[model samples]
Each structure stands twice: as structure tokens, then as C-alpha cells.
Target: MRLVVAITGASGAIYGVRILQMLSALGVESHLVTSRHAMLTLTTETDWTPEGLRSLATHVHPVGDVGSVIASGSFQHDGMIIAPCSVKTLSGVANCYADNLVTRAADVTLKEGRRLVLVFRETPLHLGHLRLLTQAAEMGATVFPPVPAFYHEPKVIDDLVDQTAGRVLDQFGLDAAVARWEGMRPLRERQDQQPDHQAALGEPVNG
Candidate 1:
């Protein structure tokens, strides 16, 4: 399978990084593009250098290269994912602003009737943010928020990152085997074993 992965200037660069890693492991071809500001976030949020990030993708495109093959609807990709999608990029896609390769690729994906997943990273959203997200969704794009799942019993940061990345891959019909809810037993077990603690933490114990 082939996919386009874009990283923006959002706070969580790791989501983009993890998505690339998951795609690589699944033997999926990834066309990577990163906004210029994404470099700053990458350095601030991860130890990986720009070179290292490019190494994860099957092909790397310059963010300014709107003429690249992936920018066209005929490029034939399974979908496009904008992990850690910033509001700027979201607005661009929502408003049909294709000034860059990332947004252009996304626009192409939508026009081609292929999946376009946006892993929006902002929080405490205002009304404008909600409207942009709604607009993107109405345009046949999936706006995925990378919210952590405590039910997975994540012990480290990687666990949380991997779970979210895995779920994003799920949109492409790729399975990364990241922790997922198998049944109610796990939650029931936790509830039965730690009712007081669950109540104290304001966690639901029963359905």
C-alpha cells in the first residue's frame, strides 16, 4: 500500500514520527512531506534529526514541491495522513487552500475519493477551530484527534504514541497490533479489583 504522510508545526511531532515508523514496519510505501515549521517542532519534540525522519519514508518530497507526483490525483495512493495536523494546515485543507504540497496532496486525496486522515493536535479548541474541523469532516476527511487511552495500561510514552499511531494506521486497513480493547473483561477486572481507586479517580467501573 502507498500513503502520503505530512507533518506540520503542531506540538506533537512524535505522532507523525510514529506514523512513519508504523508504515515502514508494515512494508507500506510512505511519501513524506513536512512543513518548514515542522522542523522546529521535530527538533523540540524529538531527538530525531531531519535526515532521520526522511529515512523512515519510502519517498521524501520537498514541502514546497507542489508539482511532485503525490500532489496529483493520478498519483494513486491508498490515502493521505497529516499526523499532528496544525490548525493552519487544517484550515488550508478545509478552505481548499493548496499552497503547499501537503495541503495539495490532501486536496487531491479528497478529490480522488481516497481516505484523508488528519490527526489534529490542538486542544481547548475555540469555535473557529470546531468549525474548521466540521468543515474538513464535511468535505469527506476524517479528523482524528490523538487522545491517549489509559485503558491500554500504557506504562511509557511510546505505548501511548504507538497506540494512537496504530489507530491511525487502522484507517488505512493496516494493523500494527497496538494495544486495543479486546473485551470488557480488562475494564471489569480493573473495576472489580479497584473499585475505590476507580471511584476516587473518577473512572467508570461498569457499563
Candidate 2:
């Protein structure tokens, strides 16, 4: 387990932070690279400082350091993940534009045939967004949007974040304690367990 992780200028900076924390807990080697705007998002969206975020990774590379080890295909690693991947970064990856370290590493990941997971954080996408995502997928990148699931019944924001991060790790075959979706209960069983909505609301239940 060695992985390259990039945090781009997306709203959910916490996704990248959670992934780093989990990777550290799992004793995985993580090479982190954060964009300038990602640092701003980290501070704006969460209390985590750039220094704190750097401490979670085994190594931290500057966003412009295209000559870094992870930028080359020969730097054998398990995979790369661009958590909270911005559409700008997505475009770069889709177009094989290696202007920055994040895109460069992603390019190398695809060229090396290693797993490249993009935790895209945009919503209400237009045709161009879809096209870019499709192109990246065709190039072997996993475009994973951080869509929250309620099957585990999240009680807090952190739970939702953890679930998304865990699911991302799942793509790399790492277990982050994500709630697996088992077969649903039988319809009759579910109905039997359902509470009386009218009674709960203090309304008289019809016979």
C-alpha cells in the first residue's frame, strides 16, 4: 500500500482529509499533493490547517512539483486518488494535460494501468461535465462522486464523510469499515416493523 492522493479545489475538502486519516490509521504510505485552492477550501470548509493535513501523509508534494516521484510511471505505487476532484482538474486528466503534479500523477496512474479514483464533487452537471467524466472513465479513471448513502443511518456529518471516504478506499480494496449493503428485508417483514405514523403523531388510528 502506497498511494498518491491529491486534494483539488472542490467544496468537500473533508473527503480528502478523511481519506488521509484512514490511510494513516491503516499504516498505508500516502503521498499527498494539495492545490492552492484546496488549502483555502480546507480552511474555509473545516478547521484543519495545511500543516495538520500534511502531518497525516507519509510524504507531501507541492502541487507544481511535476518532477516528483509519483509523477512518473516508473514510480510503482498501488494507485492514485484525487479526492474532491474539481472539474478543472478533471478536464486536465481527461485531456492528458499534465500541467500540475495532480494531473501529472493522474496521467501516470492511467498510463501505468493503476487504479485512479476521482472523487468528483460537482453537482447538477452539464453535458460538458458528463463528457469529461466519460472521457476519463474511458481512459480508466474511476469517477466516484461523493454521494452519501443512508443505508447505515448516518447520525452525523462525520459519519457521512467517513462512509464516502471508506467507499473510496473500497475501490482500492481497502476496508474503511464502510457499511455494506446486504439484501433488503422482505417487504412483509419491513411492513411489520413499521411504526404507526398516525399514532406517533398523536392522531387517532383508524380501525
Candidate 3:
């Protein structure tokens, strides 16, 4: 599967890295783009350089290189994910203002009726942010903020990123490598565990 993974100037750079690592492990082709501010934020927050990130992608292109293949809907990508999508980028996408290749690719993804996942990484959001998100959603984009549920009992920051990435990957039929939450306790009994019990032809036990 061809996946376009973009990193913007958001604090959760690790989410973008985790997405790249998982996509590589799953043998999905990753086309990467990082905005200038994104590189600055990455180096300030993480160990990888812009070149280091380029090494992870099958094809890495400049943010301004609108001539890149992905700028066109015919390039045939399964999806596009802006992990750690910055509010700036989100606004651009929301308005269909393809000032650069990142926004153009996202526009292409939406126009083609393919999946576009924006891992919006802003907090203390204002009403403007909500309005932008609503606009993006109305345009058939999935606005996935970097929020994880506590019910999953995430142990580390990576755990939270993985769970969210996994959920995002589900839309593309890619495994996020995070364990699924079956919403029940594990079944075990003296070395013989029963299959997960879903209600059958009886009065359901709400266990």
C-alpha cells in the first residue's frame, strides 16, 4: 500500500516517527514530506534529522515541490496521514489552499475519495480550530487529534501513540502493531482457555 506520511510543526513528532516505523515494518510504501518548521521541531524534540527521516521513506520530496507525483490524484496512494499535523497545516487543508505539496497531496487524497487522516496535534484549541476541523470533516477527511483513551491503560507515550496509530491504520487496512482492546478481561482456566465469549443463543450475561 502506498501511504503518504507527512510531519508538520507539532510537538508530537514521535507520532510521525512511530507511523513511519510501523508502515515500514508492514511493508507499506511511505512517501514522506516534512515542512521546514517540522524539521526544526523534530530536531529540537527528537534525535532524527530531516535526512534521517528521508531515509525511512520510499520517496521523500520537498514540501514546495508541487511537481512531485503525489500532488496528483492519479498517483494512486492508499491514504495520506499527517501525523502530528500542525494547526497551520490543518487550516490550509481545511480551506483547500494547496500552497505547497503537503496540502496539495491532501487535497488530492480528498478529491480522489481516498482516506486522509490528519493527526491534529494541537491543544487548548479555540473555536476557530473546531470550525476548521468541522470543515475538514465535511470535506471527507478524518480529523484524528492525538488523543488516546485511558481505558486502554497506555503505559508509555509510545503506547499511546501506537494505539492511536493502530486505530488510524485500521482505515487503510494496515496493522498499527498495537494490541486490540477486546473490551473484556482475558479468558483463562487451568491451561485451557475458552474462546472469547460473545453472547450466543441465550440470555446475554453482561460480563
The numbered model that scores best in TM-score is 2
lDDT of 2 by residue, 1-207 (tens): 899999999999999999999999999999999987999999999999999999999999999888889888889999999999999999999999999999999999999999999999898999999999999999999989999998776789999999999999999899987777787889898778778898999999884
Query: Model 3: residues >4 Å from true position, as ranges?
Result: 186-207
TM-score for candidate 2, please give it: 0.92
The count of backbone overlaps in candidate 1 is 0
Error of 3 at 179 (Å): 2.1
lDDT of 3 by residue, 1-207 (tens): 889999998898878888888888888999999877998888899888877877888889899999999999879889899989999999999999999998999999999999999999988989999999999999999988878866566678777778887888888887766867667655464225443355454546565
* CA lDDT, candidate 2, residue 124: 96
| Residue 189, model 3: Cα distance from true site in angstroms | 14
> Using TM-score as the measure, what is the rank order of every candidate, best first?
2, 1, 3
Q: Candidate 2 regions off by >4 Å?
A: 186-207
